[model samples]
Target: MARAPVLAAGGIVLRRQATPLIAVVRLRKRNEWVLPKGKLDDGETPRAAAEREVLEETGHEVSVHEFLGTLVYDSGGRCKVVHYWRMEAGDEPAYELMYDIKAVDWLPLEDALDRLSREHERAFLENVGPIALKAAALDGAARRKAAKPATRRPRRTVAPPPSVSEPDTVPAQFDAQVTQEEPRSTTEAAEPAISAPAAAESQIPPSFASDIEPVVIDAVPMRPSHASRRNLIQRVRDWLRRAA
Candidate 1:
């Protein structure tokens, strides 16, 4: 008898704070509150397969930020190990219309803890909670780092305010400015408006109208010739002579 190959996958149930902590779907159909997961497909790494399965099973978009932990279990006498990861779900599920997901709902973290059925589920909740919190703290520190403005050298002393007497010279400057502006404005006024030109007229000749419009021709009736009438009378006369 051949030994069965060990099957492996990964899952992460998410919980957000609310009246009830919102954890990911507990699939009643699958009988597990598993983060969407499946066996590693041929040529696919365990971690990549885990992420792909989660996205397929749950319509939610998720990014795998870090590896969480692993769970060992059994299915049909085969040993299975599931390696988990912490991923953030996008606000909207990218694959909701896909058929694999029967349904999804968010439950409170506490409620999820109380309701989760698997032993691995308990372990994951415990292990991942602290890791996630730590990850969150690290994220906070990074954000703080980003928010801190870079140290800038003291700005060079600003030049003293322009003299108040400059306003009296405005008339002289305005005359020169208007003389420069008038010709440019007049030239700009001569530019064309930016609408599409009307369509060109069709180039077809008037003689081609007969092809365009359907034309009906009357049929001429057939007429018998004078020779045929004479031949008929001669045949009748020959028949009378033969009878006599």
Candidate 2:
């Protein structure tokens, strides 16, 4: 009997920056890095699955934007079809992973293009590379454009500084112009006005002894063996291992 096709959905969760970045996830056991994706559950829509899987696998809450394309291939005697969408990630840390996902990386567009394992994924990305980059970068100059304008484009050159033929001592000239506009008092002109925070603090009322409450926080007693510190160190190590 022929193996049934498994339907799944995923996202290329991206963040807009100086260089557009795409989020990729690593499996804990296999140590393979790939785009966040998962099999669709019963009654789950492709877009919904894509958003859900991204959050679950990568812990990033992404807003689904444009649909890239479906990648269909045979794996382990079963045909798998993954529908991918371009998504924008929120400016927040991902939720905690369930330990299956080891690490999440937000790599630049070109780096991510090279990072993806599958050739089909690479090809699909290459096919929609320009559009994907344009969508990822919401600006005109930042967009990964393939076709140049019909007219010959001029190379960007640094602008020349303006030549100023003014009177000698520009600082003295500015001082004279300022004096002409506003006349300062003899004392004001003699010394610069120094503002102090203490003047503002005077506005605040002084605290009284009656405002302080007589309360005590119970402190836990430590054992002579320092078992708590050892446990804490081990826990920190475990957390670090998982994070790495």
Candidate 3:
């Protein structure tokens, strides 16, 4: 009867930089450098196992992304199948390295491939390294674009209020008619008459008429003159004579 394959999971963990770096861990017992990976725990999914294993081996918290590829090979006469995912590490490590791991190295793709002890793992990285680096570079660019502040719109210039024009000048003839008062002679008893020009000047245009106030006369009692008193007495005497 054929035995079932040993299930394992891991990550192609990257530290983002100008040029992204990959992580490879050195084993304590075997003293061999290999990709950070481990066997899946009971009831754990491949993705969860990959994230946990990479964190333990690299000591850095990571953000898991899309699935990479799977590796199937013979390990101690047993079929071992390992699943991988793309992951990004934070700037610093969050935990100590696992007891089984001696050290973790962050290296370029070529160096990581060359440093890896297993042939299958090296070949896998070489196949997928460029893909991971390209994705990381593109992701960095997108993040920078999103983080950039938006350009401000220029302020609109408000025009100043229009200047008030000088009030319309009253014609010289109209001014004379308004301000000049004719002097009356003591012997002249007749009321002053308005001339035609004065009447025409009084008919001010509607635009200027709005500024003029109407003249008002108050009703007042006047004392009778000597001539008026003499006329009244004569009228009274004539009426008395007629009655008699």
Candidate 4:
């Protein structure tokens, strides 16, 4: 029986530095430029498959911030669903990407659209362009928000402190319950686990046990031919051994 055409996931990974750069791959023999795509394995979700395929085909670790729906196209009488995602290249490029692709080029948006293989692929790129751009914008906005200092709340000023009321002690039962539920000490509370450098150093040994004398074992023999040893000589040897 013929194997099913794989359900694939891919993307037109876009990066906007000075200009929008759409990552494209050039196939081997034909040398046609197209977006990264690959087969989705069993048990792997569409989004995960898309990200993994992109990373494998082109060495770029990306965050799938948005999904660009699915595309269906026929290949050899089988229907394949390709889940698309808008990915952003992290701080640095994953690795110098090279593949069956003759060359991996980052083309300008217009150039990418014009150079893409099919109308459907072009439409996919167009659909994802806005999402990628939006992600970039949101990233910029977050950075700006982080950089700007937070405005401090105004301190309340009382002209004269009002006469303090007598401390109304709570009931014994209530106090006992509250004490039981609440943390016994500062250490037990949800305060930050801030440790002194000296304390941290003291807690961790200078050298770990594994680091000192690491266990190393030789691998066992695993030859396929070891299974059939029923020759006459072997049988005779086995008989002799059994007799001994």
Task: Name the candidate that leads on TM-score.
Answer: 3
TM-score of each: 0.53, 0.54, 0.64, 0.56
Clashing pairs in 1: 20-108, 21-107, 21-108, 21-109, 22-107, 22-108, 23-107
lDDT for model 3: 0.85
Per-residue lDDT over 1-244 for candidate 4, one digit per residue giving the tens place of the 0 to 100 score: 8666668998768765767677888778777878888887889887888888888767778877677777787766887778787777654566765557666777777788888877777887787776777777787789889999999999989699665886578789989999888855777553344333334435655455234442233444546676454343354454334333
User: Which model is ahead, 2 or 3, in terms of lDDT?
Assistant: 3
Candidate 1 residue 210 Cα shift, in angstroms, is 99
- Which order, best to worst by TM-score? 3, 4, 2, 1
- Candidate 3 lDDT by residue in tens digits, 1-244: 9999999999999998776889999999999999999999999999999999999999999999888899999999999999999999998999999899999999999889899999999999998888888888888889999999999999999999866985588789977987786655654534234133345454656566456554333434446656676554555454334333
**Candidate 4 Cα outliers beyond 4 Å, as residue runs:** 1-5, 96-98, 153-244
Select the stronger candidate by lDDT from 2 and 4.
2
Winning model by lDDT: 3
After TM-score superposition, what is the CA distance of residue 70 in candidate 2 from its true location, in Å? 0.6
What is candidate 1's local distance difference test score?
Answer: 0.61
Compared with the true structure, all predictions reach lDDT values of 0.61, 0.75, 0.85, 0.71
**TM-score attained by model 2:** 0.54
Separately for all candidates shown, the number of backbone clashes (residues 3 or more apart, or on different chains) is 7, 0, 0, 0
